[model samples]
Target chain A: MDLIQKSLLQQVAGLHDVPEGAYNIRVNGQLDSRNTTANIDIVTKEDKPGIDIIIKPGTKNESVHIPVLLSKSGLQDMVYNDFYIGEDCDVTIVAGCGIHNCGVDTSKHDGIHTFYIGKNAKVKYIERHYGEGDGNGENIMNPETIVHLEEGASMEMETTQIKGIDSTVRKTGGDLKDNASLEIREKIMTHGKQYAKTDFVVDLNGKGCSANVVSRSVARDQSRQEFFSTINGNNECKGHSECDAIIMDSASVSASPKLTANNIDANLIHEAAIGKIAGEQLVKLMTLGLTEAEAEEQIINGFLK
Target chain B: MDLIQKSLLQQVAGLHDVPEGAYNIRVNGQLDSRNTTANIDIVTKEDKPGIDIIIKPGTKNESVHIPVLLSKSGLQDMVYNDFYIGEDCDVTIVAGCGIHNCGVDTSKHDGIHTFYIGKNAKVKYIERHYGEGDGNGENIMNPETIVHLEEGASMEMETTQIKGIDSTVRKTGGDLKDNASLEIREKIMTHGKQYAKTDFVVDLNGKGCSANVVSRSVARDQSRQEFFSTINGNNECKGHSECDAIIMDSASVSASPKLTANNIDANLIHEAAIGKIAGEQLVKLMTLGLTEAEAEEQIINGFLK
Candidate 1:
């Protein structure tokens, strides 16, 4: 199956056709596996570059799709995926990474994921990162995620870095424990001299723990972005962090959302907003007839959907 | 007159006694032309440093209370006031500035006000800026205001800078015509190494002009703060700018709320937030038994009231 490995598995596992029962891992220029079942197990680390997914301990309905590809062109890769997710499980994970650089140097992807989930687990993690060809190269993604939820665990992480990725430094973090709950939804879009930075953290550690982190971003033209989120409410936990951005031409955005509490029955909140783009949302989509660059590309695709 | 000019006329013109029909300008240690009711006219320019208030064209029931003070401690002051609101007028302006430094050196105030609003005028402006004595000096204030709204005029501005000011740079601006409307409510507070910077602008030129800017701030300990608000929607206008901040400890805060829409039937919106404080609002004010610094001084006096 080649054609750039079926277009990087239909741009990151929205799989054109390949599901003899889910669980897949197909990294184009190297280790590839498929139709993985029997409660999950995928090994490909003869001591170095990436992959060893465990998952099995009661193992309820499971589904996984790990897609990674960087079709030649000054390749630079470093992957190390390790996820355990054991006790009483219910899972759905579809991780992504794609770059299909056509030349001119610089193609990098450094993914280091480690999730240990455990006690009463329920995880739904979906990730998407992409970039295309006809390239003057440089498609970089450096993602490092570490989550360990434990007591009555629950995690719903949905991440998206759509459109051609030029540079990214995203680090997702977690640790929630007693009655644990963590939800993160992030969507981003960048244009031109693109560059993105996201540093996230959520540590409500124990006693009815909860955390919700939300982000929505769109920056066009001279893109440069930064979203730093920190939510920490040590014990009687409940936290929230939010960021919303839409900036056009000569773009520049920086949202620093932070919340830290030390008991008093911890409860935290953070909010960030950067503006531009709301002339009545492009005059209500040009009164339904478009134009004005098609109503700013349909309001940046409903603001990165 | 003396006793620090009767405590700078009872802490900035809430004059312990001085009435007889309205319009007042009492700038102690310098320009004091008290009890001025002839429909506005106060001039003091022996060639330099500040004061020219004019408003006379068919002036109706005018009520103006100008407050300015700084009782000793090596005082440094600058004031330039100019306002002329004529046609079909209705006015109420209580401008404020107070500082009452005690010793060690540094007491400064710089105020520059300019407003020209005519045509169907309706104005209500209330300002309160204060700083107390018992000082090791250093209580500075710099304010610059400009407003101009002519055609169906309207202006409602309420500003408050509470607590002891140590440093400030506040610049307020406005310009709106046709069915003009402008509302500004700003409240600020700062602790220790106090430093505050507020830059604001609102410009919606004509047609159904509108603008609203709301800001609330509180920065504790080693204080440092910045809030920049900009709302510009030229023409079929409607604009909103909001900033909310509270950061404690080694306090530091920055919020930039901006909205610029150049008419596609302009409608703009902006929101900003900086966080800290709020652990369920200090556990519902310590379950009503107060303490926790009296529930954070009763939530910073109801968030700067």
Candidate 2:
């Protein structure tokens, strides 16, 4: 195995070897797609350097893991990945990006993803963006994702970006049909003048559609961040957005959460908060003989987890 | 009675007669220091137009109500009031300011208050700042308050400013000694391009001191607001700060709550949030036959109260 694959697996999949040919892996604009299980297949896009995943109707019990890696500095990777899950299918996908910058120039990745869920389908997706380098190059990621859920469909996403990234802009939105539900849980951490801005908009377009967006972030040193989330209700739906951040030193954070209800039965609520780590939490650990820095590290790990 | 006196009585005291000489009242810039007890006396400052009240030792069962008023438009008033609370004393002070502007020019008021509480003194202070006018003049107020609590002393302050003020900047700070505690509850509401900024800094300088500062605000129709609070813990102390705001109709708000601890036993926490009104809250009220405006008004009243 090459250094690229080794680092990618460790950072993203947390595995030693590939999923025994049951998954797809993309490395430096190269794609390796395998395992045609009669109902699920990965096809390369004709127009772009990306992949198109299709799940046939009634397909079930399929798990796919795709980890993308950007290993060289001055390299920029862009992928447009789309997923089409048919009716009554249940699947899980583990997707992530790992970047290793080793030069003076910046290493950036832009992952644009779209998901289409058929009626009564259930999808669980997890994505982690990790950056690790000792060079002066900046590790940047800008992810744009959109989800379309049919009636009775449900989608749950867990997205995390913890440490090592210098800059990021994440945009995620979803449109839910009747009886459909969507939930996103995001965690972010930045330090040493790093900047991150995350924007989210969820539209409850049909009756009984529900959406919830929850985020936790930590900004240290001179890092800066902005979080904006808006939930628009068009029917008898329920929506809620929440953001919590910890700021230290000269760090700054701005959290703008808004909820708009157009129908009389629509219900939406939003909340955001920006502050420092609790002193009591640190003291509790200190009483157990941990240093302040150790206590902060433990707290951040717990918060992000 | 003169028109100024009538307006002052109605605006500040909420009375037709002037307390029938039973209480101390300050109308506009005049000081009425009457009904002096052997333990409590209100005296005019030698260098300033304001007054100072000195409470001798063993003073108990004394209450003071002094509501300042700014009735004339284009008129600015500045007052410096000081209170010396003696040991073993229990007192309640109701101090507030009301402005009725009705002119083309701006009317302003600045109040600087200081309190010195001795050991075992329990003080309950309530202050409300209100502005009401139908004119083009801007009603502005800047208040600076400092509290010094000795050992075994406790203080509770309830401050509110709900309507008609165009602009304000409020700054409050307190220093607590051993076994001293301070709590502040602030409520503010603004509309129609009004602006307000509140800053608080509490220092828990002695052992066993605790402090809590909580604020709630409503900003509507392009109004702007900012709330900044920081509690510094230096000993075996406890501190907490919280801020909640409701933003509507293009209004904007920024809340920054912070805590700093220098001792191993210090414990501090802060939380803040900003968003629009929840749709379910409105629906619950509207189901009782109230219109949207009526429902919103009811919610705001309940929240601010």
Residue A272 CA displacement from its true place in model 1, Å:
3.3
Q: TM-score of each candidate?
A: 0.40, 0.62
Q: Candidate 1 on A1-305: residue-level lDDT in tens?
A: 66876776787767875655645555544766666678888877778888778888878777878888778777888888888889879988888888888899888888989899999789899899988877598899988898999998898998999778889999999988898898999999988988999989878889988888898988888878887777666677777777777777766666655555544455565555556677888998898898889899888888778
TM-score of chain A of each: 0.39, 0.96
DockQ value of candidate 1:
0.04
Query: Native-contact fraction for each model?
Result: 0.04, 0.00
List the DockQ of the predictions in order: 0.04, 0.06
**Model 2, range B159-206, lDDT digits (tens) per residue?**
888778899999999999999999999999988989899999999899
Please list all clashing residue pairs in model 1, or write none if there are none.
B50-B79
lDDT of 1 by residue, B93-165 (tens): 8888877788889888888888888888888888788888885888888888889988888888888887788
Global lDDT of each model?
0.78, 0.81
